[model samples]
Target: MSDVFSGVYEINSPDVVSEYFEDQAVILNLATGHYYSLGGIAGSLWGLLIGGHATDAILENLAAQQPQLVEGASAFVAELISFGLIRQARAGAPGMSIDVAWTSEAPKLEVFEDLAELIAADPVHDVDLEAGWPVLRPQS
Candidate 1:
């Protein structure tokens, strides 16, 4: 992986909610009770983030997995930050990257709701969304 492709992030889904499918780029934030979903190119970038990949590494990986989205990775990442889906680690760490973790608490709801809406409205009804939706998956 390149400088842009090193780090890891995890996507979390709600344990109580049950309205969406798996494979959707939906995440919930227990701290803020917010929901977020990354569809299309944004979805890919979100995946990279959850994988614990650094921002740069995310861009590089996305460039390869989704060439058409390479150009938009930077902006998309910025948007994700603005949306509070991700955050930087330390203030001055080299290769400092954002980390995404999954939560099942009530307070955290940033990514879950957004992802649910996306899954319900997916025009293509992509199977990937089915795999990502935590609600649709069998309980462990």
Candidate 2:
């Protein structure tokens, strides 16, 4: 496998769900029942990544503007990859045209495991009709 980090990337979907609210983002991996939060530079980078900007393009632009943040940005990307939240973009994928303005602060990824059991709960079939979702049916 290639580790050059020179291609566009996309969200690992189906099992992963994410929402960006204002300056922050919340990402949940349904497969593992773990969630993550991103703020500051990390959120901005995630916005760009999901927006279809090429990894190399983002890094190059950041390097041209900030220079010092290249290392941190790369590490952030690596961390995202390690978390299985993103994957390389498919061929002929359309790219985003918008520009990304990153903050001076380093990127940060906050992982949360407190909600694993809650997230893993099956709201569809495991719920009591009287209590509705989030209320598991009593085991017989």
Which candidate number has the best lDDT? 2
Instruction: Please write out the lDDT profile of model 1 over residues 1-140, one tens digit for every residue.
Output: 33232344333333212223464555555445455654554554565555455566655545554555554556566555565556554322346453423222111123445445444433444335466633343334
Q: After superposition, how far is residue 22 of candidate 2 from its true place, in Å?
A: 1.8
Assess every candidate by TM-score: 0.43, 0.81
lDDT tens digits, residue span 14-130, model 2: 878899877689899998889999866888888888778888778877877777887888888998889899987785244555476766888888999987876877888878989
Pairs in steric clash, model 2? none
Q: State the RMSD for candidate 2.
A: 3.3
Give candidate 1's total backbone clashes: 40
- Reference-based lDDT, each prediction: 0.47, 0.81
- Cα error, candidate 2, residue 125 (Å): 4.4
In model 2, what lDDT does residue 75 have?
85
Q: How well does candidate 1 score on lDDT at residue 71?
A: 47
lDDT of prediction 2: 0.81
Total backbone collisions, model 2:
0
